[model samples]
Target: MEAVLPVEVEIPSMRVLAESKLKEAEWVKQCYEQLNFIDEKRLTALCHGQCYQQRMARTFNKKGRPREFSPGDLVLRKVLHIAPDSRGKFAYKYDGPFIIQEVFDGEAIILNDMDGNDDALPVNADALKKYYP
Candidate 1:
């Protein structure tokens, strides 16, 4: 069997080479401009997101009243989840006439039972409401 040799490719002229180089430079410039445009778009999106978050926070905070509790205050602890063995909808929502033993920063509090036994962990102030006699 005889093997066929590949044909030689023609070299481009100087004029063609110069034209191709100009096109390449133009393409590079276009790519750089696109990159800059994308960066500007990303920065604008980030700023808009931050502004949206600030607006939402401001609106929410305007409607909210801060809960403040001090030591020796009687409060009721909200029951989170009902036991499976107990009554479902009929179960009591609030648990305690617990006394506020200690108050911490950020609305965290320690509670004491009626017998004066301190709770093991601190609870959020939102979970407790003032109990009146």
Candidate 2:
């Protein structure tokens, strides 16, 4: 009866236990640092939410609609088809009867396409559209 050793005999070496603890602590520290970094990045708040949506799109485009064009105007060219073999969303937006020719200033314009294509390019009077008839 003098040899009664009844108990869970878990014998972990002191050195091994200490090493394991150190490693675990290091891992935890690294994880914390990583998490902190991620939070900071997010905090940039997606770059101030894209600079507050570009300052609310420059204050709602300053109440838009200032599209001015001259030089033989006959606009109508806003068909930016985002093809997926498009023809959905009620297609036929507008596709030029162009023919501005030149009016660079308040909105730049120099379109031309009634088969009279003379290197047509510069166009931005809000994508043009004022060809009534």
Candidate 3:
């Protein structure tokens, strides 16, 4: 029996198909994100018509965040303070009056308002200090 050569598939169409699939993805996922969460009760209710209440997790007081912010919330940026001997060439210390660009459940804040330009500095909820009203 003679061995048959594998069939060559078109690559361009594959790329187009992949792009279409990406565009079809949910809006919440199109943007860069690592993880996402939703109300388990709501999901359960939708699936089984049951109501649920929120409860504190093990790290509630430690890691639990209970705040929210808008796109224009002013926040202070805190970075690691670098002592030449401790951090290296640059001092890794808290810097800035960077205004929060976007807030993710107040658990994370994106800052960049420096000289009127967005800088793409995202920080953990604990790292940023918001200006008190």
Better of 2 and 3 by lDDT: 2
User: How would you encode candidate 2's per-residue C-alpha lDDT over 84-104 as one tens digit per residue?
Assistant: 777698777888787778887
Candidate 2: deviation at residue 73, Å? Answer: 7.4
Given candidate 2, what's the lDDT at residue 25?
Answer: 75
- Candidate 3 has its poorest 10 consecutive residues by lDDT at 3-12
Stretches of candidate 2 exceeding 4 Å from the true structure: 1-31, 34-36, 39-44, 72-101, 104-106, 109-133
Structural RMSD, model 1: 11.8
Order the candidates by lDDT, highest first. Answer: 1, 2, 3
In candidate 3, clashing pairs total: 5
| Candidates' RMSD to native | 11.8, 16.1, 19.1
lDDT of 3: 0.58
Global lDDT for candidate 1? 0.83
Report the candidate with higher TM-score, 1 versus 2: 1
User: Cα miss at 43, model 3 (Å)?
Assistant: 28
Best by lDDT: 1
Tell me the whole-model lDDT of each prediction, alpha carbons only. Answer: 0.83, 0.71, 0.58
Among residues 3 or more apart in sequence or in different chains, the pairs in candidate 1 whose N, CA or C atoms overlap within 3 Å are none
